[model samples]
Each structure stands twice: as C-alpha cells, then as structure tokens.
Target: MTPETVMEIGVQTMEVTALLAAPLLLSALVVGLLIGMLQAATQINEMTLTFVPKLMVVALVLLFAGPALLETLLGFTIRLLEGIPELIG
Candidate 1:
C-alpha cells in the first residue's frame, strides 16, 4: 500500500481501538475520581477502597458495552479484510 493508504489504515485502527476502549476507561476514570474525592473527604486512604470500586465499575461497564464493542471491532476487521485486495494491488 501507499504511504497515504497506510496512514489512513493506521488512523482507522486507532479510532476503532479508542472507541472500543472508551467505555471501560471512562468508567474507571470516573470511579477513580470519585473514590479519590471520598478518600480526601473522609481520610480513609485505603488502596483497596479505590481499587475494588473501580474494578467493579469497569467490569459492569464491560458487561454493558461488550456487545457494542465487539460489533465495532468486527466491523473494522471485516472492512480491513475486504480492503486487502485493493491495498495489495
């Protein structure tokens, strides 16, 4: 493939990756921020207090968003595979 085509593919790959990861990452970020605030307010300062909640929220997010994420990744994979001939020739 040409350099432009390669770059385009790279950009699309990154976009798909970000889209798939955003939900879990965002949930973790929000949970962590809230936990941090609570820790500051109450002076709990326990590591597991932060870790467990964020872990649970992330798991919940994944459970809810998993199907959509899978669909997006599958779509991207199919599109990339279909474009292989054009890219090669």
Candidate 2:
C-alpha cells in the first residue's frame, strides 16, 4: 500500500518479466545475427529467410527452458500470494 512497497512490487514484476522473456529474446537475437551474417556473406537478401530459423530456435529454447521458466514463474506467484497477508497487515 505504501509507495515503497508499491515500487518494490513493480520492480519485482519487471524483473520477473525480464527473466521470463530473456531466453526467447536471446535466442531470437542470436538467430537473427547468424542469419544476418550468412545473408551478408552469400548476398542473399531474402527478408523472410530469418523467420523460420528464428522460430525453430525459439521453439527449441522454449522446449529446453520450459521447466525452469515454469518453476521460476510459479515460485514468484507463490511468493507474491504469500506476501499479501504481510502487505495487508
């Protein structure tokens, strides 16, 4: 309820969001970079060339990181719910 508490909650929310999104975003970035390099070297300027590989990499990353991501989100949710009583008190 307090400004400090509200700010803390907002910061934690942002942190959790970033943590959850990092893997997918990083995979996309890496795939894009590699595709860019390949396109530059081969002079193939196909705009859609990067999409499929990025999608596949993202899928693979999600497949591998899904459990840890779920665990992290679940932990954060449980912690947030548990803190409600403390915040109210």
Candidate 3:
C-alpha cells in the first residue's frame, strides 16, 4: 500500500474505534463526574463510590449502543477487507 493509503486506513480505523467507544466512555465520564460532585456535596469521600455506578452506566450504554457499534465496526472491517486487493496491487 502507498503511504497515503496506509494513513487513510489508519484514520478510518481510528474513526471507527472512536465512534464505537464514544457512548460508553462519555457515559462513564458523566457518571463519574456526577458521583464526584455528589460526594463533594455530601462530604462523603469514599474511594470506591464511583465504581459501581460508572460500571452500570457504561453497561447500559453498551446495551443500548451495542448493535450500532457492531454494525459500524463490521462495516469498517468489510470495507478494509474489500480494499485489500487494491492495496496489494
């Protein structure tokens, strides 16, 4: 593959990865921030307080977004695979 082709593939892969991961990561971030704020307000400094809620929120995000994420990844994979012949030639 040419250098440009390689860079294009890398960019596509990263875009797909970010799209698939954004939901859960964002959910976790929001939950963690909210939990932190609550802890601050209540003066309850628990080391492990955010873990369960963050996990649960991320799980919920995955449950909701899993199909879309899989479809996106599959589409990217199929496109990449289909381009292999052109890349090799």
Candidate 4:
C-alpha cells in the first residue's frame, strides 16, 4: 500500500477501535466520577468501592449496546477485508 493508503487505514482502525470501546469506557468513567463524588460527600474513602459499580455499569452498557457495536465492527471488518485486494495491487 502507498503511504497515504497506510495512513488512512491506520486512522480508520483507530476510529473503529475508539467507537467500539467508547461505550464501555464512558460508562466506567461516569460511574467512577459519581462514585468518587459520593465518597467525597460521605467521607467514605474506600479503595475498592468503585470497582464493582464500574464493572456492573460496563457490563450493562455491553449488554445494551453489544449488538449494534458488533454490527459496526462487522461492517468495518468486511470493508477492510474487501479493500485488501486493492491495497495489495
């Protein structure tokens, strides 16, 4: 592949990765922030307090958004595979 083609593919890969990970990551971030705030307000500084909630929230996000995310991933994979021939040539 040409340099531009390689760069474009790299960018696309990063975008797909971010899209795939965003929901879970974002959910964890939100849960962590909320938990932190609650801890601060209550003076409950437990080191492991955020773990379970973050895990549960991420699991919920995956459950709800999993199918659509899979579809998106599948579409990207198909497109990338289909472009292999052009890249090789």
Candidate 5:
C-alpha cells in the first residue's frame, strides 16, 4: 500500500479503537465523577469506593454492548480483507 493508504488505515484503526473504548471510558468517568461527588457530600474519603462501581458499570456496558461491538469489529475486518487485493494491486 502507498503511504497515503497506510496512513488512512492507521487513522481508521485509531478511530475504531477510540470508538470501541469510548463507551466504557465514558461510563467509568461518569461513575467516578458521581462517586466523587457523593463522597464529597458525605465526607467519606474512601478511594476504593469508586472502583467497584466503575468496574460494574464497565462490565454492564460490555455485556450489553458486546454484540454490537463485535459486529463493528467484524465489519471492519471484512472491509479490510476485501480491500486487500485492491491494496496489493
């Protein structure tokens, strides 16, 4: 592949990576922020307090979103594979 094609693929890979991670990361971030707020309000300075909630939220997200995520990844893989001949040619 030409440099441009390589760069395009790299950029797409990054985008897909970010897209896949965004839901989990955002959920954790929101849970962390909410936990932080709750801790501040109650004056409970427990660091481990946020960990469980974030983990649970991420797990739930993955459980619910896993199929869609898999489909997305599968679609990308198929597209990349289909383009191989064009890339080689």
Candidate 6:
C-alpha cells in the first residue's frame, strides 16, 4: 500500500477502536466522576469506593454494548482480511 493508504488504514483502525471502546470508557469516566463527587461531598476518602461502581458500570456497558462491539470488531477484521491480498499485491 502507498503511504497515504497505510495512513488511511491506520486512521480508520483507530477510529473503529475508539468507536468500539467509547461507550464503555465514557461510562467508566462518568461513574468515576460521580463517585468522586460523592466522595468530595461526604468527605469519604475511600480509594476503593470508586472501584465497585466503576466495575459495575463497565460491566453493565459491556453487557449492553457487547453485541455491537463484537459486530464492529468482526466487521473490521473481515474487511482487513479481505484487503490482505490487495495490501500485499
């Protein structure tokens, strides 16, 4: 592939990765932020307080987004595999 093509592929790969990860990541971020706020408000400085909610939120996101995420990854993989010969040729 040309440099431009390689760059394009790289950018697309990153975009797909970010798209797949965004829901779970954003959920975790929001949960963490909420936990932080709660901690600040109550002056409850327990480090572990953040872990359970974040884990639960992440798990919930994965439960909800799992199918879509898997499909996205599968599609990306299939496209990449289909392009392999073109990439080599």
Query: Best candidate, lDDT-wise?
Result: 2
State the displacement of the C-alpha of residue 33, model 2, in Å, after optimal TM-score superposition: 0.3
Off by more than 4 A, model 6: none
Each prediction's RMSD over C-alphas, in Å, is 0.6, 0.7, 0.7, 0.8, 0.8, 0.9
Q: Which 10-residue span in candidate 4 carries the lowest summed lDDT?
A: 47-56
Candidate 5, 32-68: lDDT as tens digits: 9999999999999999999999999999999999998
Q: Against the hidden true structure, what lDDT does model 3 obtain?
A: 0.90
Q: Lowest summed lDDT over 10 consecutive residues: which window, candidate 1?
A: 45-54
- For candidate 1, the lDDT comes to 0.93
For model 2, name the residue pairs that clash. Answer: none
The lDDT-based order of candidates, best leading, equals: 2, 4, 5, 6, 1, 3
In the range 1-89, model 1's lDDT, one tens digit per residue, is: 89999999999999999998889999999999999999999999899898989999999999889999999999999999999999999
Q: Residue 73 deviation, candidate 4, in Å?
A: 0.9
| Every candidate's lDDT | 0.93, 0.96, 0.90, 0.95, 0.94, 0.94
Query: Can you tell me which runs of candidate 4 are displaced by over 4 Å?
Result: none
**What ranges in model 1 sit over 4 Å off?**
none
Per-residue lDDT for 36 in model 4? 96
lDDT of 3 by residue, 28-66 (tens): 999999999999999999978999999888888888889
- Where's the lowest-lDDT run of ten residues in candidate 6? 1-10
- Between prediction 2 and prediction 5, the one with superior lDDT is 2
Q: Report the C-alpha lDDT of model 6 over 1-89, residue by residue, as the tens digit.
A: 79998998999999999999899999999999999999999999999999999999999989989999999999999999999999989
